[model samples]
Target chain A: MTASGGPAVRLVTGTVLDADGAPVAGASVHLADGPVPLPDIAALTGPDGRFSFPVGADGVYTVACRTADGRGARAAVAVGPAGAPPVELRPG
Target chain B: MTNGPHTAVSNQPVEITAPAAEQAVFEGPSEGAQGGSPAAFTSDGLEQVAGHTRALSESVPAEAWTAPSAPLPDIGEASFGPPDMLETVHGPDDRVQITDTAAYPWRVNASLLITAADNSQWIGTGWFIGPHTLVTAGHVVHIKHSGVPGRDGWVKSIQVMPGRNGTFLPFGAVTSTNFRSVTGWTADGDENFDYGAIVIPTELGAVTGWFGFGSWPDADLLKTSVNISGYPGDQPPGTQWYDGRGVSSVNPLKVFYDIDTAGGQSGSAVYRIHNGGRYGIAVHAYGGLTTNSGTRITKAVFDNLVLWKA
Candidate 1:
């Protein structure tokens, strides 16, 4: 709605832990909004820690992750359009 | 030393490097494998599509797009989404740092078109809709008349650029239209009726102004958090936001926003906040929505739509 570079509204979620913290079952969580980028927008986490994406009209996000025994993490969050304010996952 | 075939291809200065999100749905060339002109992949076609994408980026190793196990949900503790952490850490020569702000302003917008066999390129996501109507995703701008089997798409010329690092702001003077299939219709390039409506003469707030469309919200905006902007030509381009969590639900025609969209994001505009206000609908068209394949599944007149002032 204003995404080609700037104007507040960016939402991108994550959560799929393992390696001491627990919570990693049948993972398939993905999110990409740029042309050709893909984690493949997936969702399969329902033991408790949720996953959602109504996505931005706000801005600032750069989140990345790779699990299922791959072990990876990248972080940055700034979603604002009056939403996106809860995300917590610990364990390298 | 050099000044012949236009100074030897302009003294060999080709090193643009800014289009990698996985080819963003392959723009610029390859319209049905052409036999003549349709090979715009200079730099030797990016070195033969980077040697056919280096064995598919070394056998699917974007870390395999992650997910071994992690869908948290245990009582006494709660998790919404996005927490296994890893949001932009590219460094293995993929090189991603991105930090140039004099006025970032959230910046990141996109809308492309050039097809119907006329040198391939269909990437969308630019919905202003009135001010010169510009909505996207009818397969990224109509295209289905070749060999005519069902046909329901055709419009090649609609450019509304804003950002993706090259920092653009002027490019809008093209229009195309087609969206009148509201029956038991099944398949005709069915991207779930992959919506499309661009009638731009000039007025998307003249550049950026207008956003609001809702209906599929019955309850549970899943994870209830959002934000997703488009315009991707990775390696630190302009706009590419993400913070997913709206894992598929509430389906009348379509509504799935795990964020993550490519091919320039079909016709992106999936925001949330409903009830109190703050809507921004038009959730990911064709970039992702494969519950089936015969897409065109429409039915939401809602009085021609224009609601978002509550």
Candidate 2:
């Protein structure tokens, strides 16, 4: 994978929303059965329920999320050098 | 410290072998265990290949060959928190998570779900050193200067899960209260002394295998390729990640590197791979924007590991 400033790397950012289409707060988002990464403790969504992961190469990666109340969702996407669009996760 | 670039990979296993007598292993930290002689520092850490037990049962078909089905009790030490939990990002985060953790090497690293003395939960990494002993960062086991009243001693408990990929725990999890650290770390809270060990009641390591650690000369170490793999909090919960890079710097007490790492990766092994052997050169702890470092394996630290693993 590319380093922090390596031109080959790009960010894949998105948000976690509920069935109501409102941004969910305090959601735990992570790679779907993949390598571990940053964020000192847990990979948590921000106040806006947004989460992000780094895409180093051209491939498909799955991003999954869950809330304390048991709502969960996941998205599998293909990324390229130009980077992919943001993903939306909605757990029933 | 932050890493610029790294040849990051998943938890892919290479050959694991005994130290093939690298004369370098018997070098450096030229001091005796108790102020005796440089000979004291020349000892090699205990390493085992997977499928073999470090301590076997007396009967043929020893229990060591099989895992203990009975659950382990949760034993923990004093308070724990992030007064100094450093996970620096130098650039874009390029960590690769490992889901194929049912194999060698990767299985040695553990996901440390820590229950601090204050009852707050935290996460960190640790690795097997012996059949029943796991090595980790001192702060992971004991909190210091956390600024919380009555929350700076032995943590309450730690659930050690080896080869944990998300929720797929191939080697089932075990909780423990028993731990070991030096006075320098526990009393002084010194960064240089930030290393410790966890002793589980079972010999789970015999199944996962363990790394051999040693203290080599400062000159012999520069630019050596090193590997670091552990559970980072930023990735999926309980997922293991990995990266390999060259040693960036070294002091009498630490070995610095450009390997990409983050928080919760604290206590991961900074190991050197040689002729099929993995030797822990340091116990990873502090992180910087440009370079992350670990408590170097020296005479004092090696002696502690010797005693703790026994």
Candidates 1 onward: DockQ, in order? 0.03, 0.09
TM-score of each: 0.27, 0.60
- Give lDDT tens digits, candidate 1, residues B1-310: 2211111100113412222222111011111111223212222112111212221232355456431221111210122232232222121222122222111222223444333333232334555533454445544544432222332234335555533334433333354432222111112333334444455444433334344444434354433434345543221223443333333443445444334343344455555444433334444543322210112112242212221000
- Could you say which candidate leads in DockQ? 2
> Per-residue CA lDDT of candidate 2, range B10-40, in tens?
1114312222232333221111111211111
Candidate 1, residue A45: Cα displacement in angstroms equals 24
TM-score of 1: 0.27
The docking quality of candidate 2, as DockQ, is 0.09
Error of 2 at B131 (Å): 0.4
Quote the positional error of residue A77 for candidate 2 in Å: 33
